[model samples]
Target: MSLKSVSAKIFAKIVVLRIQKWANNPIETQQKVFKQLISEAKNTVFGKDHDFENISSFENFAKQVPVRDYEELKPYVDRMVSGEKDILWPGKPLYFAKTSGTTSGAKFIPLTKESMPYHIEAARNAILCYINETGNAAFVDGKMIFLQGSPEMQEKNGIKTGRLSGIVAHYVPAYLQKNRLPSLETNCIEDWETKVDAIVEETKNQDMTVISGIPSWVQMYFEKLQKSTGHKVGDLFKNFNLFIYGGVNFEPYRAKFENLIGRKVDSIELFPASEGFFAFQDSQKEKGMLLLLNSGIFYEFIEATTFFDENPKRLTIGEVKTEVNYVMLISTNAGLWAYNLGDTVQFISTKPYRVIVSGRIKHFISAFGEHVIGKEVEEAMHKAISAFNFSITEFTVAPQITTSEGELPYHEWLVEFDNTPENLQKVAEYLDSEMQRQNSYYLDLIVGKVLQPLKIISLKKNSFQEFMKSQGKLGGQNKVPRLSNDRKIADALVKI
Candidate 1:
């Protein structure tokens, strides 16, 4: 082995040791982490405003700092963006991670010097943990390609602003840079299509061992690579063995990805968002991601069913129960306090606190009292797809509220198919049935004749991509909302 490979293995082993120490007692680790975060931010404006000094317990902290969404926290973020120092953190943030917004045009999430290590370390530890668990460290010797957005960041009010991946790329350690693929110059290409082409040309003959990115974009790149070489990804990169994916659930695309790779490769799921690097799949034996308890972020959970209540019950790590879906609230080193990340998760294990990302609070359809969430839709789609032998490229669900007089409303699905099933109607029926099985409210609406059966709209190839492009959200961290209460996205898809 080369000297760099030997050093990489040693670093991975050290990270594994650290992960074991943290995993020894998750509860105690979280407690210590929370206290440290509070102490670090005690002198900041938000900290003094909330009297963080006197808060000794999680209860006191929760009571003193009311849970806040992006809207409630916008003023502080705005002040920071306007170049205010010590507004939310101890000092000005190094950069801002830009994310898609609902009401606002875009959200500028802060990334501080202190918090940067947590993001980088968590990702590094995830890979190390995988190596430790699977005894597969040889991949570290080869190139790892991160299929992400352009590394070119724009400056906003003297703060660098860009996609989280781009920001993270700026901090990749020098050692790993030697084994990273798709040269920095190619990574800075503004257009995703042009960038993918450049990446294919640069890495076609390289020793690529791991590929990481959102599944859809990675699939697109894989397809392009195959088209260019006239060979499957596995044939092109014989050493390729690991796929690290996040930003979306992989179940729907699992079959498609395996086909592209020409084999089933080991994969890892990550829960990194613009807000924080929250959780990662730490074990091959475990079904869910092990929550990063000691990361520089304090986590709180509120029952998803009561998330909109005037006073929702905030539960600490000690109070959280297994199998219950809760909206995640976070207070991080990067100046966010009791901020709602909008994600809902269910704890599959409580001893070490492994969680599955259930869905988003905003990504749900509740027309006529029949509330349906992203999880239900995704599960239903997976079942239907499997039964019908269909492969989907992309899909989104929206409630069709408008109808003629005496006509019942229904859910509309705009789907882009990679391989269409024999009968589209059967596929739609199976999906509706699976959804009804999962959600009792949806079933009741159908049984009571309150709503008609769901309708499927087969979108032309690249329809969703066209829609995303039209909205100026074609690449990077941008994702199509899977479930929307309104028909805005659906109508746009139809027009496309």
Candidate 2:
């Protein structure tokens, strides 16, 4: 083994020991984090506004601060963007992770100096944990490629601002810099399609042993490699054994990926976002990710079923139960207080707090982790049909993940038109264009060829009503969901 691989194995064991220390005392570790957050930010603007100085317990903190989404938290973020300091966190943030928002056009999520290291460490620890468990650190000696956005960041009021992935690209460890693939110039290419092509050219002949990216995007890269060299990804990089992914559930894309790579490889699932890096797959034998309780985040949970109810009970880690879906609330070191993360997760193991991301709190479809919400689709439909004289009665969308060989998956929109449009294909194009404009993730998937433009399926008149009637609710408050990640509703609509 190379000296680097030997060093990595030694380091991995040390990190795993630290992780086990906190994992064994999860609740106590969380309580410490909560107290520190309150104590440190008590003098800041948000803390002062929420009366954080007088708060002595979780109950008091909950009473003082209400759970807020991006729309509700925009006032403070806006000030931060305009160069205001100490508005949210102490002094100023190190960076702003700009992401597509539902109500707000773009969301600027703060990344503080105090909290930023955790993001890098959590990802590193995930790999280290695997290495420590499996005694496989040889990948450290070979090339690693992280398919990500442009590392070039723009300055917004003297603070660096860019995509979360782009921001992370700047922080890659110095030790691994030599082994990382796709030259800096290639990584800075703005167009994703061109970037992927450049990446394939740059890494195809290298000793690549670890590949990291969202599964859909990685599949695109794998397809390109296979087309160019007439070899599976595994054959192209003989030592490649680890696949690191995030954003969406891998099961949907697992078969496609295995087919492309020509074999199964070990994989790690991460729970990360602009808000924080909350969890990572810590074991090869586990079903869920290990939640980072000791990180600079305080957690709360409200049962997702009762989230719409008035004054829903916010439970702490000690109170959460296994197998129950709860909308996650977080008060992080980045200065978000009782922020609604919008993700629903089920605790598979409350003992050490391992969670599986269930779905978003809103009715939506995220088969590729595009997070296309109901409002965006409705607005897109309105824009798409603005030039036409016809209107659709009702519509619902579902992801069509299962496809024939060599065909990409797509969103299947079932629509009951008031009167059938003259050219249905033209309408589909307009609707797809509007969706791409509204959701950046959806746009990326389209441009990357990971998904085809959404396909519109026409439904006969009263199809929705007839389906609802069959379900014993013809009318009166019972409504069809606008979008689903699964195809149950779409199948029923097709059958009707």
Candidate 3:
């Protein structure tokens, strides 16, 4: 083995050792992490405001600090942007990670010198854990491509600001830089189509061993490479053996991706956001990602079903149970205190604390009280696709509430198809049935004649892509919202 591979194996072993200890007693590890985070920030403005010093326990912390969403925390974030020191954290943040803002306008989340390493370390440990589990360290010796956002950043109030992926691109370890692909120049190109084309030209012949990106963008890159070289991705990069993906569920696109690659490869799912790297798929045998309990983030959960209640039950890592959907709340070294990150998750394992990303709290349809979330919608779509023997490029659902006097309200789906099925009506019927199976509220509405069966609107090729491009969210950590309560995105797709 080469010296580089030898060193990588050593490092992976070290990380795996540490993770083993952390995983053995997750509740204790999380408690210690929460205490450390509270202690570190107790002197800051937010900390003092929330009486953090007297917060000796989780109950105290929960009682003292009210849960806040992005909008609620905007004033402090705005102050940080305007060059305030010790306003949130002990000092000004090193940078801000800009979000695509599907629910709200653009948000600039803090990335501090103290907190940034957590992101890097968590990602590294994810790879290390995979290596430890599978004995696959050879990929480290070959070229790896991380199809991420541009590294080029804009300055705001003396702080560097860009997409989290772009900021992370600037921090690729010096040693691994040699094996990374898509030259920095190509990465800096802001336009998605232009950058993807450049990437295809640059890495088409390289000995790529690992690839990482959001599933949709990676699929696009694979398609472009196939078109240019007239070869499957596996044929072009024979060493490609691992795919690291985040920002969306991979199951819906798994079959299509297998076809594109001409074979199946090992895969890892990550739960990284602008806020922090929270969880990762640690074991090949496990269905969900193992929560990073000892990371520089303290986590809390509120039952998602009653999230909007006047007084929701806030549970710590020690209190959360298995198989219940919960809205995630986090206190991070990045200076966010008891912040609701808006995503919902369900724990599948309580011992090591493994979770699956359920959906976004805001990305739901609740018109007429028939609530439906992204998970249910995706599940329904998955069944429909399988039953129809077809594949989808992308899809979104919205509630069509306004109708004529005689018409009932219904759900509308805008789907971009990779393989259009012969019978769309039957596909729509199956989708409706699957949704009813997943959500009893939806089923009751259908049975009561309060709502009509879901409608499927076939989207032209690249319809969703055009819409994302128009919204300045074409690539890199941006995703089309899966379910919307309103017709804003649905209307745009129809117009397209």
What are the TM-scores, per candidate, against the unseen true structure? 0.96, 0.77, 0.97
Every candidate's lDDT: 0.88, 0.85, 0.90
Output the worst ten-in-a-row residue range by lDDT, candidate 3.
97-106
Compare the candidates by lDDT and give the number of the best one: 3
Q: What are the clashing pairs of model 1?
A: none
Off by over 4 Å in 3: 102-104
User: Which structure is stronger by lDDT: 1 or 3?
Assistant: 3
The digit string of per-residue lDDT tens for model 3 on 1-496 reads 7777777778888888888798898878888988898888888888898888998999899889999998899888888999988877899999999875545688999999988998998888888888877878889988999989888899998999998998998888998999998898998998999999999999998999999999999999999999999999999999999999998998788878988999999999999998999999998998999899887888999999899999999998888898788999998989998899999999999877899999999899999798798888888887776777788889999998888899999999889989889988989999999999989999999999999999899999999889999988898888888999989999999999
User: Which segments of model 2 are wrong by more than 4 Å?
Assistant: 364-496
Model 2 CA lDDT for position 289: 97
Better of 1 and 2 by lDDT: 1
Measured with C-alpha atoms, the lDDT of residue 455 in candidate 1 is 89
Candidate 2 or 3, higher lDDT?
Answer: 3
lDDT per residue as tens, model 2, 386-493: 655465656789999999999999999998775677998898898899899978899999999999998999999778767876765332213466778899889999
lDDT of the structure predicted as candidate 3: 0.90
Candidate 2 clashes between residue pairs 3 or more apart in a chain or in different chains: none
Predictions: Cα RMSD each: 1.7, 13.6, 1.6
